[model samples]
Target: MRSALLTSGTVALLFVLNALFTGSLVSGFAMPPYILQVLCLAGINIILAVSLNLINGFTGQFSIGHAGFMAIGAYASAYVTVAWGDRFRAATSFLPEFARDGVLLLFALAVGALLAAIAGFFVGVPSLRLRGDYLAIVTLGFGEIIRVFILNIDVVGGARGYSGIPKLANFFWIYLFAAITVVVVSRTVKSSFGRTLIAIREDEIAAEAMGVDTTRSKVISFVLSSAMAGIGGGLFGHYLMYLHTNSFTFIKSIEIIIMIVIGGLGSITGSVLGAILFIALTEGLREFSQYRMVLFSLLLIVIMIVRPQGILGHLEFRHFFGRRRRLAAPTPPVIP
Candidate 1:
């Protein structure tokens, strides 16, 4: 009951904070739209990093094709919204315009996630048998294939890109889903299944010897990660109101992996922190766009040399900021 109440209160707080960032409120406060948009983008990146961490960090899978799933989700969701958006709005006649669009946004998001999961299954099932660099190579190829395929498909504007997608994703949806991603991934990492996944990560042979289905767990992790990335992609496409095949290329996948690595692999909180800091850095250096890549490469080298484990390493931020409770002393048993 306490936990339930706490969860509800947390959610309420998130929504309240979200309302403060709405266009009207921001305009009232004279806050810039770019800041709001960046915040939303950061939230989306957090979702991507956290989801990818589930597979790479906790599950010990080296998947370089995350952007492929993102592309699938983006294109799929964009197509659905463009083709069937009016139908969805009309079907939700009882709802307010904003509420109706929100509902349909969620539906479209789900559609994107489903399509990504299907793609994950096909990629994961066959390639999961491979390990290490082989898996990485296969995933890289997969991402490239997806990008090339999308470039040729004129239906989605092909190489020209898909445009005019509904701007349904805003700070509210982005942050809400980002929070959900963290919570879900956190809970999942603490569950029995998570332990199994971690065991596989620690040592696949040992885990298999212990009767854990390494391949199965890997596939499950891959699929779950892909689904979340897809959802993030849907959010990204809708927010930008455009989709380009190039946007979901190998470089984007590298960016996500960098976020997870610099945040601290195998740590959910680290991934979130990493995404936040990484985006902030990227934005801060936006003025030096020409040298941005060089600057980050140097920074990464510094971090790798000075602090190999990243900002958090294997520890949670809670360890630093959270209030610590004292353990109660055990009462002495009375024999008499």
Candidate 2:
């Protein structure tokens, strides 16, 4: 009951804060409302980066086709929302009409996640045999293929892109999902399954010798990560109210991977912090325009030189809290 109350209180506080930002109660040199947007983006990217880190960092699978999953989710959800949303809204006129307005959009988001998960399984099965740079190339190729397919597909507006998507994304949904992602990943990492994944990362051959189903584990991680990335893609699509194949390109995947790498691979906390810092830097440097990417590259190089392990490496919250408790404990009387 205490935990539940605490959760409720936190949620309420988040909602209130969200309301303030949305209402433009806060303003500054940086359009404060846009700060909320950056937060939302960071939250979503945190999900994507952490999930992908499970595959690439924890499991040592060099897959780089995250953008492919995002593309699948984006177009699939957008198509469903625009085409069948109004129909469902009309058909469900009986239930408080306002509810119907956004429900379809939510349904589309679910469908997007489902489709992306399915795609992950498909990609994972075939590509699991490859590893290292080869797997990276294959995954990169997958992303390119997805982009080309979207371009040729007329149903989703092809090269012109898709528009008229419902603006269903807001702080409520974004943070809610973000919290869910963080919790789920954190719990999973602390579980036995996560141990198996780490073992695979350390030595896949030894893991297999020990009867661990390495392939199955990799596929499971890949599917889950892909599904979450899909959710992010859906959120991005609705938030923008329009999307193009260009949005889910190789560079986008690279950017996300950079988040995981700079944040500290294999660390969920690192991913979250990394996402926050990356987004802030990306947005803060917008004024520099042409120099932004250059600066970002230089920053990464500096981080690599000084701290190649990434910011947090694989440390968890327990590390700091545990230390705090030890420090706070009363010291015994010193011997005379």
Candidate 3:
């Protein structure tokens, strides 16, 4: 009950802040459009990073095809909104315009996430049996296959790219879903199921010897992660009102992997921080234009050399603070 209340309050607070930023609640006051766009992109990246962290960080699966699932979600959701969105809006016309649009967006997102989950299940079942580099290869191939498959499909625009998707995503919806992704991942990590995943991550053979279904746990994690990625993809598509296979390439997958690595594996808070910092740096370095990639690569190299375990190193913010508190505590009297 307390958790529910806290979640609700947080959501309400986000809504109000989104309204204020968008100037819905204040006269002649609004965040700059470019900044707001960056924030929304950060929210989407948060979803991607946190979800990938679940599969790769928490479960130690080493899958790097998140962009594939995201692509699936983007195209699937775009198709729904492009085809049936008007029908859904008309059916829900009794509600206020905003509410009706929300419902439509929700339905489209659900469709996209569902399809992506299905893809994850199929991919996980066969490919998850492999480990380490083999697993990475399989997932990499899968992502490329998805991209190529989408590229050939004329229904979704083929080489022309899919367009005309409804622009229903906004700051409120994006951040609300981002917060949900974080909560869901954090709760899962603290649950018994998550503990089993961790056990597998630490030692798969030992976990299997202890009667834990390691493969099954990994598959479940993959599916959940893919669904979350799909949600991010859906938001991305709707916000841009377009879809392109080029956007979900191997480089995109690498970028997400880099975020988790820089943030620290197996740390949810680290994933969030990593996403924010990654996006900020990418945007901040835009002025360097010709030298942007070189500068970004150098900075990442420095970070890795200085702190190889990442900024947080498998620890959450709470854990970090608690450790400091313990260290600062007075020493107990020696009985001598």
Candidate 4:
């Protein structure tokens, strides 16, 4: 009962924080709801980073086609939502009493995630055989294939893009998923499976010798990570109510990678911090928008030069948030 109370309290605290961050507080900023968009995008990016971190940072794989998985979800969800939206509203003349107005939209997002997971499974199966740069190349090729496929698929509006999606991705859903992502990932990383994943990263040969199923771990991590990316993509698509093949290109994949890389490859908290920082920095650099990428590139180079391992490489949450364990109090200096 105490534990339950604590859990409920934490949830309530998170709810309050979400409202404050997402709701209108100050009148002078005039930032609009787009800040919520940034928050959602950052949350999704954190998932992608942490999930990919499991592979690259913990499992020592080099998969790089995250954006492809995201595209799959976005397109899949878009198709269902558009088709169902047309039919449901047309037939019923309005949403049923049993249905919230946003039910279709939410369902479509889930469907997007499901389809993306399937795609991730297929892609992971093949790419799990490759390692390092070879795996990166293979994943890159897969991303391109997805992009090309979307470009030719007229059902999703092809290159011209799809629009008219209901904008139902508010802060509530976004941060809820974000919190869930963090909780799930943090728990997973603390499990035996996560330890084995880290072992694989430390030395795959050793892990294999110790009976760790390296390939299976890699595939699972990749699929889960890809699924999260897909969900993010769906949120992104619905938020804009429009999406184009161009949005989920190789460059987008690289940006996701950069978030992980800068955030400290293996650290979930770092990913969240990094994503928020990246978005802020990108937006802040608007003064030199033309040279924003250039400036970012220079910053990355400097960080790499100074700390090639990454900014917060592998630092756990306890390092940042957990209470400090005091050393034994020197036996009170034998005061007696």
- Residues 1-336, candidate 3: write the lDDT tens digits: 998899899989998988999998998999999999999999999999999999999999999899999999999998998888888888888999999988988998999999999999999999999999999999999999999999999999999999888789999899989999998999998899999999999999999999999988999999999999999999999888888999999999999998998899999989999999999989998887789778768877987999988889899988756545445668899998
User: lDDT by residue for model 1 over 1-336, one digit each (tens)?
Assistant: 997897788777766666776645455663367888888889999999999999988888888899999999999999889999999898899998889989988999999999999999999999889888999999999988988988898888997789979999887788888988998888888898899999988998999999998888889889999999999999999999999998998999999988988989998888998898889999999999999999999988998998888778877766788978678989989998
lDDT of 2 by residue, 1-336 (tens): 997997798788777766676764455423366667788888778778877887887887887789889888888888888898778887888878546755776788899999999989988899888879988998999888988988999988898989888887777677777887887777777799988889999999999999999999988988988988888888888777898999888999999888988999888888888888889899898999899999989999999999998999888666776654444668789999
lDDT for 300 in candidate 3 is: 77
TM-score computed on alpha carbons, candidate 4: 0.87
- Superposed by TM-score, candidate 3 places the C-alpha of residue 130 at a distance from the truth, in angstroms, of 1.1
By summed lDDT, the worst window of 10 consecutive residues in model 1 runs over 22-31
Clashes of each: 0, 0, 0, 0
TM-score per candidate: 0.93, 0.90, 0.94, 0.87
Candidate of highest TM-score: 3
**Stretches of model 4 off by over 4 angstroms after superposition:** 1-31, 86-99, 324-336
After superposition, which runs of candidate 1 have C-alpha atoms over 4 Å from their true positions? 323-336
What is the C-alpha local distance difference test score of candidate 1?
0.89
- Which candidate has the highest lDDT of all? 3
The TM-score between candidate 2 and the true structure equals 0.90
lDDT of each: 0.89, 0.84, 0.93, 0.79
